[model samples]
Target: MDIKQRILASSCATRWFLFGLVLIGILSLISSEWLVPSIASADEQSGRYLSIWARLATTTGLVVFEVAMTTFLLAVAYLLLTPRDDRSGDVSVIEGSDVGRSLHEHLRTTESYWFKGRSARWVRDVVFPILSNRASTDQIRINLFMALPDPSNVKLMKEYADYRESIAYKGSKDTWTQEIVTTHILAAIVSAYHNASKSNFLNVCIGLSDWFPAYRVDITDGSAVMTVEDKNAPAMRYTRTSSFYSTFRADVEHTIEMGTKLPKPVSSFRNRELDATFVNEILAHAGLSGTLNGAVNEESILKKINNSGQLYG
Candidate 1:
């Protein structure tokens, strides 16, 4: 094995060794003090000292044994009852990036990638990387349904700005206003389209929807990862096998079924018309009608994004 593997193996071995020591020490104390004992008469002081020592040792050993046994049982229950990383749904509900790892391990290029979420943060961090690495086939389709920005109502916008400043953000609330967050998401989509290999076919459409629960569907010919939403914590991501890819794919199709034409792959010169149209739509969704009307270009779009979604136009 490699050095990293060897180190990991060694570390696991050390943990087992320590646990074994705890068990062995407790058993040895029980055997010496209770199972096999010597009775010898002595003075009262010496007898009292012996009695106290025996009780202390017995108590300590029993506590150690009980604690160790309980810990082992709890760990076993967690392993058996808790979800495995490899599968989801009726199978199991594994937590954290195990869902991502398991999907990557078995992911095939023919698999379709679908994501519906409030922000595309998980898409940018997890789904994009997985597809970029594993899927090599032509005609890859990514279906995304991201929450759209609130339509421009000055009162609502001000309220949202206050809520964002008060509730949802960490660090300086000034760092990312609601509109800035939407602009960043749009920028990510634009980047994805621009950077995708032109030789390989890629059809990705991001539709704007409101209050869609976040989930990702990555389906191979054999296996799939259908992320389960934790409603109490929408940010938490977990997945089960995709028994629902078809339904999800249909849902995504139905949203785009509004006759939204897929934008052509962006480039420095080619596909400017399609890019412009797509960017305009994205800007309008972010409540930036002023920037859209002022002849939205790359510079103006980026400027609004950098200036916290305030269109100076």
Candidate 2:
């Protein structure tokens, strides 16, 4: 039935029930007066007092009955008027936009990038350690985002321990390690695009070397050398150096050539064929193809030296 019809029916039923109960109670009280034997009295005063007491008792019972009926009727009315059943089916998909808008507004009101108050402690102690130990292969990758102010731009640093533990000892290599390293390298390349001038480039190089002391860095006008060292013994190093890049043409060539030597572990999300497709996708994103022309491609590489002399495994 419709809401209005249901409410009307319930109200009518409740009124009738209350009327019947009141009528029965009144009849019982009247009957009690007639059925009870009169008490012997020494005077008319006692008789009068007894009649008054009976009247008062009957009034009290009627008052109680009225209060109970009123309360019941109010409760029934409330239930009948209240909504029932889920409205989920009636809601449109577009209705979710309002919820999203509200959440966005709330975030905007409370948003702050700088840690303050209690959050400062977490940022200092917790986040720094977690960032330092992110890689399972005893490597920590740090990315310098493009938006940051230079003297430091387009910088990437990796600090790793020079040891390989067997998988049997629960100290094995993880499959995701290479992928994580690649991501950090990719982030550094992306950051380089933001620099408006080459003056900041040298500063960026210097900042990276300082940030990751484990990696020995030697930067010249057109070439750079980076060496990843053993954590236990800093004296030991695995070095990789790039050839001269006089122009952007030379730089692009060196970046791609260096990228080729990087290890590609089995991707969790892609099969071999899919992985090939994904690599092509990244190349396309970087606006790089297999062939590099001297003019259009700003960078060119003269040579690359990978010093594996100290590499144990």
Candidate 3:
């Protein structure tokens, strides 16, 4: 047998043996007391044999009960600690081709389920159109060094931005930017759900940066802020600040309000991660990586990009 099988077998054997030992101890204790007293009226030799038999029976009963209780406790512990795997290892052949497809499909499905559809559609139709436009295409390539605990989050965010850009510049130009903004909102929602603690606040900030044309999102211990400078509209230049608690609370409240405003048939809460995936994918296609990291104290992302030289000449 394989190692896993061997291990399983050994564990089972050990458990049974322990149960047997417990039963033996219980039997010995009973035989020396209760069994011996019950058979005192019988001949000495007869009484001794009877008492021994009684003890053996009692021990067997005790062992069975102890083994059952131990098994039950072990099963409960296993269920609590084990991470569930939903994927089935079933394969089907269609036209002699393997059924397995690209990971993008998996991402798409996950996003679809997580977002509940609206967020996903917004990214595709709105976000991508804005980011991939040639007129603003250069703005999408700005680099903001991120210090995220999980690089996968950054990589995923980047891939989604690129994907959106590709779709936006399919043929014509005039890409849209609002889509990127919407994506940032979605990514924030997703990050908040996955890592609710303060330590992960940076990830949320970085993920939101993709939407801004110029600025980056920064998260410190106290609050989240945006910083930027606007050359075209100097009047709009200023640092914007919002507490992480306030921002998340506002987002949740806004979502709840939006849900309430929707028709009864569409008023269901969606998984934040799924919504984030849709937003990320859509924004990605548009060449927008809305605020995945940096300072959020700027008046506008465009202004920050211009001030920090995040945008190319």
Candidate 4:
């Protein structure tokens, strides 16, 4: 039967069972007074049986009462302890720049970046610059989670870019379309991840999946970066940031927990596929010619950064 029917059936069964027990209990108590006198007059063996039956009935009745009372107590406790629905989403807002600053200040930090946006250009624009100017003592452990570049996601992003261009710059001669920009940012992030893997200063993990949410969270050692995507805006804003141990932090943790539980990409580190075909496609699409060939020389990358001008520190 369906859920409602099953629920009704179970309720009916429970009610009847409880009613029967209550009736039996009342009868046993009433009968005990008269039965007790008869038990003393009956043969010893019959008297023993009657005594045992009476005790069993009394014990069963007491057990049912206790179970009912305990359930009531638990229901009351749950009502008292649970948070109100109105305040469930009550996370404190933190500026995106402030979050960027926390990453800049920490010498050693742990972080996770989760996103389902086109290219995640913000990382290259905001995150990379902070890391570039870090002190010699600075180190970062990062877990980068991105939505798998499936056909549907690509189509969605392209449509979004078209809408953005129509409203933001209809007549501009900009070479960077939404698709190209998104690929570029993905390439930049991946390139940085590769370089970090070669260094003691940064440790990185990557998870690719098609089931990511359209939000971004960067959780570091002492602070968290959180934002919800606004479809109407040109970009998503970092809406909340808090201590790593705050209630907001707990919500971020839950988000991470859900993300990790999804199926990992087939060409993942877990599967020992270091140079996955998917990774190469992203780099190639971004026009990073030699990144797929493991030709990323440390000195060359440093020089490129140096030529890029003012850092964000």
Q: TM-score: which candidate is best? A: 1
lDDT of each: 0.45, 0.29, 0.32, 0.43
Q: Per-residue alpha-carbon lDDT of model 1 for 1-313, expressed as tens digits? A: 4434543556564465456657766766765576434322233436543567776776577667767765775464334433344223433444544554555554444445554433344455445545544434434553333232222333443444455455442333244354544444455454445334332444455554433333544444434445543322222223333434455556655654542333444444233333556566545443445523223355544554334321111
Give all TM-scores, in the order shown: 0.42, 0.20, 0.21, 0.38
Report the C-alpha displacement of residue 302, candidate 1, in angstroms: 7.1
Question: Residue by residue across 191-223, what tens digits does model 2's lDDT show?
Answer: 222111112211111011112222232222222
Best by lDDT: 1
Ranking according to TM-score, highest score first: 1, 4, 3, 2
Of candidate 2, the 10-residue stretch with the lowest lDDT total is 299-308
What tens-digit string does per-residue lDDT give for candidate 4 at 118-215? 34445545554454334224554455444333222455446555654554533344444544434444554444444443434443333333343344
Candidate 1 local Cα displacement, residue 290, angstroms: 5.5
Error of 3 at 2 (Å): 21
Error of 1 at 190 (Å): 0.5
